[model samples]
Target: MVSDFRKKKLLHLFNKFFDRDGSGSVDRKDFEQAAENISKLRGWKQGDAKYKETLDTLLKVWDGLQSVADANKDGEVTADEWVSMWEAYAKNPSSAYDWQNQYCKFIFQLEDASNDGAIDSEEFSTVYASFGLNKDEAVAAFQKMAKGKANVSWPEFQELWKEYFVTEDPNAPGNFIFGRSSF
Candidate 1:
């Protein structure tokens, strides 16, 4: 049910994080490298209190995701595996539904935010970081979607937010957006 604009935006986000060569599709190495870079960037300083804090935060986030990701008897997660993992998480986000709701609600509450009801660059970075993506890679990924434009519409936000779960619908009617893949 995503509009073309939203789908493109989501894909653009994915491209920022996972398409190292600037190709549209994500490869395994690209995904791995980004994850590693994010970790390293946040945990670079050894013996610093901030490093420990970052490590603790990273571990906490990973631990929460691990139970859901340790599928198919593998200790390591590949790109497709991780994508599928998030896809499942998006479907039933009971673990942090209230948290996510409050986060989005807070974004909407910002005065001078915008009439479109979406958070802007600074707001998105702050909120997205608070959601566990506290690194440049994460910021870049979000920027790809936000595009520094003032306020994405509510429907656009909803559509892009739900993208981790929904596949593109290729059979869209006239004037409707369709999935990128074709039969």
Candidate 2:
């Protein structure tokens, strides 16, 4: 299951662009505009090859989940029309492993401190630099092996992976929580 911290961060990021009116909730136009803007941000310029390519990619992604948003027989997506979109995205479906893989690759690119296709302590700090953590907190996480080594064991890697997406805290406010399951 996902962690509250990750949910909060995703919600914050989603709201920043989706909730254009600052109403804490996304409206119809906001969803389309946000998608368009995201397309533009991804090196898609008007009348450019990359623009069409990126839009096509987005359409492919959204079309597969059309029922989640194309609710009114109008072939368009709305804000309320995307309730399932966010939920599905947040749930991290097994079938969407490629999506998660892509995200991981992005993080790896940002965190590869050694720039050798692997993450170490320094890479993790650079990736999370925006947090502005003090030296002590940063050192604690690094010392604790928060970032996996060049050759990380499966068990050890899962722990580091969980830090960004799965909170171990039992009292966190979120729809899902992670822990040792008996089943």
Candidate 3:
């Protein structure tokens, strides 16, 4: 059963990033647009290595999402499908879904601009801002997610992400991953 707590966060994530076109479902075009948007946000031009890398990653992420979440094999993933698919692995992820873990690492590395193992408060909002999420909310989220630390390390990031998916506790720092938003 997908508890209401997990369902709320999953829906928030879906509405914010997955269903990028506000089309109620996710398709390749959404990933493509996200790639373009993130690339543009970073000033990465067409054919630039970074741009290409992000595009490829988003595309592959979509592929992985489809394979696992498109239960009807219809090429589009609905919010329910996405949430259900996540339910299968949210508490105990498997190696077969390593893409999900890699995706987190990708975001962490993106924000850790200094090539350091940690992300500072300012860098915390990079991806959220690209997704057009409120910057102030993202900063506030970072403050909460960081738990008073000056920076969030890769290990801490992984923990927070896991908490976001699996923890039902209302006060979990991971609950603030995407800042304040109603799903």
Candidate 4:
């Protein structure tokens, strides 16, 4: 069973990402807008390699969310569907972990500006900031993940991602991944 704190966090994430239109639910247009925003933030243009990469990543994520959260086959995610999905995920952690693991790898690849297979604090900060983290919060999160080191590897990132989604501790390093937000 998911802890109350974890449940709240999951809802917060759902509301943050899926409820873009603030219409109390999420539809295809919201996902499309989000993808467009990401592409714009990355400064991706048509015919560019990075554009294709970013587009693919965004589409993958959008598809995943829609497939998993839109339980009624209505092409929309309601609050009930969102809650049901997380509850089901809580019962089967591995499925959630597998999806999140893949997502973390995608994020790592996007943030590793040098293509070094790891991300330094500065790169980490930039990525988190794009997700709404302030500069200081992003740095703190980086330090927490780095654990006195200079960079974070894929395995370590996977751990952090799991903790970020599953752990209830507000002060946990993973909690800082998305920066300071009211839970």
Q: All models: lDDT?
A: 0.43, 0.43, 0.83, 0.70
Cα-based lDDT at residue 10, candidate 3: 88
- TM-score per candidate, in order? 0.39, 0.40, 0.92, 0.79
RMSD for all candidates, in order, please.
Answer: 9.8, 8.5, 1.7, 2.8
Q: How well is each residue in 1-183 modelled by candidate 1, as lDDT tens digits? A: 344543453454445444545644444444345444444544445466644554454444344444455476454444445465555555565544443344234334431134455555555554444334454544454445544455455556545545433444433221011112222
Candidate 2 structure quality by residue, lDDT tens digits, 1-183? 334545554454445434656665544555446446644444456678755654455444444445444667575544444444545554564344443444334334434544565445554543333333344443435444532233333344434444434344433222111111110
- Top-TM-score candidate index: 3
Backbone Cα, N, C clashes tallied per candidate: 0, 0, 0, 0
Angstrom error at residue 24, model 4: 3.4
Tens-place lDDT per residue, model 4, 1-183, is 567777677766667655777888887677666656656767776667877776666667667767888877887878778777777765656677344555667777877878888888888777667756576777876787677689888777767777767676776766655544345
lDDT tens per residue, model 3, 1-183: 998888989889889877889999999999898888878877899889999999999888888889888999999999999899888877575443867886788778777878789988777687687788888888888888888888999988888878888877877888876655333
Better-scoring candidate (lDDT), 2 or 3: 3
lDDT sort, best first: 3, 4, 1, 2
Ordered list by TM-score, greatest first? 3, 4, 2, 1
